[model samples]
Target: MGSKPRILVARAIFPDIVERLRTHFEVEDNPGDGIWTPDALAARLADKDGAFTTGSERIDAAVLAAAPRLRIVANMAVGYNNFEVDAMTAAGVQGTNTPDVLTETTADFGFALLMATARRMAESERYLRAGLWTQWSYDMFAGGDIHGSTLGIIGMGRIGQGIARRGAHGFGMKVIYHNRSRLGAKLEAECKARHVGKEELLRTADHVVLVLPYTPAAHHTIGAAELALMKPTATLVNIARGGIVDDAALAVALRERRIAAAGLDVFEGEPRVHPDLLTVPNMVLTPHIASASVPTRRAMASLAADNLIAFFDGRGPLTPVNRPVAHPRGY
Candidate 1:
């Protein structure tokens, strides 16, 4: 066997990043972006010591069982629901996620999505392009006002806090949020925001933004029941992971004008939006690009790469999620 550690790059990354990894280990990269079946992944992982994976790769017990030599799984995305933590821990394989680097960029996109949704930017642009704006009227494309509006936020994590600060201090809007636990009073004061229950948040806010993580418990946090709670003039924004909201229900609400408007950067079945959402006139849809800024994406990749490098160097990973599984033979 060769002395160098064997690693797999599950998807194509920056060429520079691949070159860097090549310098450290024997790199097997999927340059063609071909979809690998679970069995194929397991077979490839068998001889590998570690892997560089994106959110699409599933690092669960079955794959780990097939690859007893595997040590670390470095994920390029901030979210790691793609991983099965308990399974990884039992198999004694480490997991790391890229974070902090994507926070500001994602926050920027989230705020922009909210503004675009409230202002009917996409719909108005389409109308003009379709030659429907031949004559301008006083109320032509008069959308919801964002400034001095009530901004209700769900899930007060880093990105959520960033949005709250912008809405509260920058736009002179009142910000209310709901989270798993209450943020400290100091943080609340810093953001100039208040905390409220989910229902109260949905009912009271002029604009609603979702920034929570995705978990089975958090699935469909916003669905038919919650959508019904919002004001008919209110706008909704989702910049979090897809499954956090029920896309089908959201589409129904948009098509029926049950809600004034919605801005979605992620969907339950992403890269493939609901047909109803496409038919809706009051919706803005975007593929998941909340964290796609140039610098941020590079940082995220470098951070994941760093985790792999550190793990191979006999040092702890920089941002390990399943840290307890950093060792083999049962962590």
Candidate 2:
């Protein structure tokens, strides 16, 4: 084997990032951005010592079984739910994700999606594009007010706190949040947020946003019953992971006007939205670009690369999701 560690960049990334990796390891980069099948990923990983991955790739037991030489899987996104962490830990594979770098950028997108959905921006744009704007009519795309409205946030992490700060301070909205645990009094006061139960947050807020992580337990956290709880005038925004909201049920709610509108940056089976959601006129959808600001994305890719370089360099990973059984030595 060569003295340098072998690494695979599983997805296309910046050329600069690839060059940076080349300096440290024998880099096998998929610059074409091909979506690798499990077998193909395994085949490529068979001899590699580490990998750089995005959220689309799933590194589970089967993949671990194939890459016996793999020491680390560095995910370029914040959410590592795509990774089977327990399996990676058992197989002595360390996992790391980019978190803090994307917080503010994602939060900004979440609020933007919320505002766009609330004001019926998508619907209005479609109307104009269809040449339907002959004259202004009363209540033509009239939507709910964001200022002084109740903003409910689920999963009060860094991004959630960022959204709360924007709503509470910039928009003069009342903020309430539900998380795995409550924030301290000082933090809550700073954000002007009140901790509430999930049910209350759903039933009361004028707008509800989901920023929680996805786990088996958290799958479909907002579904038919949960959507039924929101007021008819309310809007829902999801900048969280796909499968967190049941796309089918959400589509039904929007079609029936059960809620005013919805903004989805992530979907259940994305890049492929639900057929029903495609037909709903009251929703704003984006292709998972919440953390996609140029600088932020570069930082994310750099962080993922840094994790791989650090792990093979014996310095330890900067944002390790799990401690591996043994560190890479003599690489």
Candidate 3:
């Protein structure tokens, strides 16, 4: 505590963001953005007083044990499933995340994935690319309709409401959602979204989108049993974290033509996809890029940097996820 606080940028981010952190702290950054094991990450954080982490890095009790001087960790992504919040709290370390900045961008990508999934865009592109489009028939590559259809959204938070507004106002689609809690009357009216039971949403909607956060209780939320409730022609989209949807079960559903198609922006154990999911022709997969827009990403990085700066400046954390009851180690 006698010297200036040192921080680790756990992953490669905007160079400017690193420089911004440098002004306030002694910074050690990973320009290469290499994926690090727990031991490796712990080694870097061993001397750091703070850290700016992207969503991929895991910060838990083990890492915290190695970094006795670390006081704060700021995550660039709103979803901090990678973090062990309870563990960090017990270790007297603060956790922060960037929220509200990427809501619109992520929602936009969610809708785009929905449209592409419902319209069979990727499948058709693949067909044409394989030089199999010798002739065009009236019903060729026909997919489900979006307009006048029921749009079911899970996790009706900020991004969910954005998608709801888009569907209701722009596409004339009926929006229904299921969340941990129901939205208020005025807010629901604004988005034209109705809160419904999960079963009802799955069974009735023509399209379903998952925007929920990742938690142990939320794992495989849309598994075999839930998929069985969805209509055969319904298109599914997951822009949320991996492990939210059971990719293996989804692949089975897709292969058996149980569902029309699916679009997945995140996957389980990614960037290594399920072998079955990769082979399923009816699903559209992305490499966790739903929030990858340059501006949004920069904003996320800036916010994370700001959190680190704020904590070191004695302003505390701006978007803290947990509170530590004890003082920082060596403070």
TM-score for each candidate, following the candidate numbering? 0.96, 0.98, 0.97
| Model 2 Cα lDDT, one tens digit per residue, 1-331 | 3399989999999999999999999999998999999999999999999999998888999999999999999999999998999999989999999989999999999999999999999999999999999999998999999999999999999999999999999999999999999999989998999999999999999999999999999999999999999999999999999999999999999999999999999988777989999889999989999999999999999999999888887788999988744557786
Predicted candidate 2, C-alpha RMSD: 1.0
Clashing pairs for model 1 are none
Against the true structure, candidate 2 has what lDDT? 0.94
lDDT to native, each model: 0.90, 0.94, 0.91
The candidate, 1 or 3, that scores higher on TM-score is 3
Return the candidate ranking by lDDT, descending: 2, 3, 1
Number of the top-ranking candidate, with TM-score as the measure:
2
Candidate 1 per-residue C-alpha lDDT over 1-331 given as tens digits, one digit per residue, 9 for 90 to 100: 2466889999988889989988888999999987688899999999998999987788988999999899899999999988998888788889999989998899999999999999999999999899887887999888999889999999999999999999988999999999999999999999888999999999999999999999999999999999999999999999988888888898888888888999999887666787888888999888889999889989999999998888877677989987545433322
Query: Considering summed lDDT, which 10 consecutive residues are worst modelled in model 1?
Result: 322-331
Mark the regions of model 3 whose C-alpha exceeds 4 Å error after superposition: 324-331
Better of 1 and 2 by lDDT: 2
Question: Could you give me the TM-score of model 3 versus the true structure?
Answer: 0.97
